[model samples]
Target: MNFGTKAVHAGVTPDPSTGAIMTPIYQTSTYVQESPAKHKGYAYARGANPTRNALQKSIAALEDGKFGICFSSGMGATDAVIKLLAPGDEVITSNDLYGGSYRMFRKIYEKFGIKFHFIDLTDVNNITPFLNEKTKLLWLETPSNPLMRITDIKALTTIAKKNNMLVAVDNTFASPYLQNPLALGADIVMHSVTKYLEWP
Candidate 1:
């Protein structure tokens, strides 16, 4: 299906009980069960929700990704990605990217010992100088925040893969309709749903 068709129908199914055409807002914090071991796929709001599951599926389909995980905010999703690294691991990213992401890298994760190299990514060759065994991830933001600089995703991801580094692209600025980083060889792709998609 095209983006428009997938956007509307990809992960949603009609409610069998009410025959509602859209996934209903599962507002309750918990679900009922026949027994302690038998229940529908949710336990608590913090863990999962039917409404969120539908949204995740729609996003995954849009990105041509295997799965999608929703977060309260874009930063929350970013924090989850960074948590994959341990102390002493490193990341390479563009200096022209999002300010919130920059602050999160420099202020929050740096103290945790995850070193980030902020450089000019417009010239993909600039990333070569920072390549090292310590680098565990390559983060990219195309049509980047504020400056709106574009980075060549396929070119940079190719180089990153050669070094065995996982590549992640913050696609909030470009949106899935404009670019799908996973198809370009990024291991992970992130989006702030509130930005272009405009829904949780």
Candidate 2:
């Protein structure tokens, strides 16, 4: 199906029990087990919930990716990605990243031996010198923070691919409607849905 049609019909269906036209929130903590090893799809709420799974599937479909993992907050998503880097791994990132992300990388992750070198990503040449075998990730935030500077996603992705580094973009500013980083060759794209997708 087309993008517009997929957006409307991708991750939702009428409620079977209530016959409602929207996906019902499954607000339970646990599901009944038919036997010790045999049971239904859901086991625990923390691991997965029907409503959250629907949203995850919807987002994965929208991004045209195979997997989508939802977290409690944007920071939670960032933390999950950072876990992929082992101790002593190095990351080359934009200096104009979100304040919270900068703090997390500089203060918290640094204690575990993950080194972050903040560079002016606007000058793509500056990033090339920093790439090495130990560089595990390249973090970007286009239209960065309060500056609103646009980095050429294609250019950066090319450099990252050449260096054998994983590229991650914080897409909160652009959202999926404006930009799809995965389609542009980024390994990961993140967003703070609380800022735009939620009701005030």
Candidate 3:
């Protein structure tokens, strides 16, 4: 399907009761249930909401990813990816990426015992020396936050995959319209929806 079509219908379904074409924003703390543990797929507002689910589904479809997760902020999404690692696990990331990401990784996750290597990832070879058994993930942000450094997604993913590491890309700057990192072999693609997306 074309991008325009996927953008509209990928994760969306007509409202069952109202038959509204677009996904509705369900504004409530808790959903009504038929019985104990028997709700319409939504239990708590913080846990899951129909609107957020639809958005996540649409973004995932656009990125060609199998699954999607929505978070409160870009840092929240970054935190989720970091949580995938163990205490001693290492991540090699682009030095030119977002400052908030660097703060989250160094200030927050570092205290948790996760190691990070912030290096210039403009050329794929610059990352070679950082590879090791402790390196569990490859983090990237391209058309990087302020620097506009473009890392070759396919080349990086290829190397990371060869070493059995997961590759994650922050596609906020590029957005799904410009690039699909998942299609380029990235294990995960993250976006700061507050920017390009109006639904924050």
- Residue 86 accuracy (lDDT) in model 2: 98
lDDT, candidate 2, equals 0.86
List of clashing residue pairs for candidate 3: none
Model 2: lowest-lDDT 10 consecutive positions: 191-200
Ranking of all predicted structures according to TM-score, beginning with the best and ending with the worst: 1, 3, 2
- Stretches of model 2 off by over 4 angstroms after superposition: 1-4, 16-19, 197-200
After superposition, candidate 1 runs with Cα above 4 Å error: 197-200
TM for every model, in the order presented, reads 0.96, 0.92, 0.94
lDDT of each: 0.92, 0.86, 0.90
C-alpha RMSD for every candidate: 2.1, 2.4, 2.4
* Per-residue lDDT of model 1, residues 141-186, tens digit only: 9989989999999999999999999999999988988888999999
Q: Which candidate number has the best TM-score?
A: 1
The 10-residue segment of model 3 with minimum total lDDT is: 191-200
TM-score of 1: 0.96
Query: Which one wins on lDDT?
Result: 1
| Model 1, residue 83: C-alpha shift (Å) | 0.4
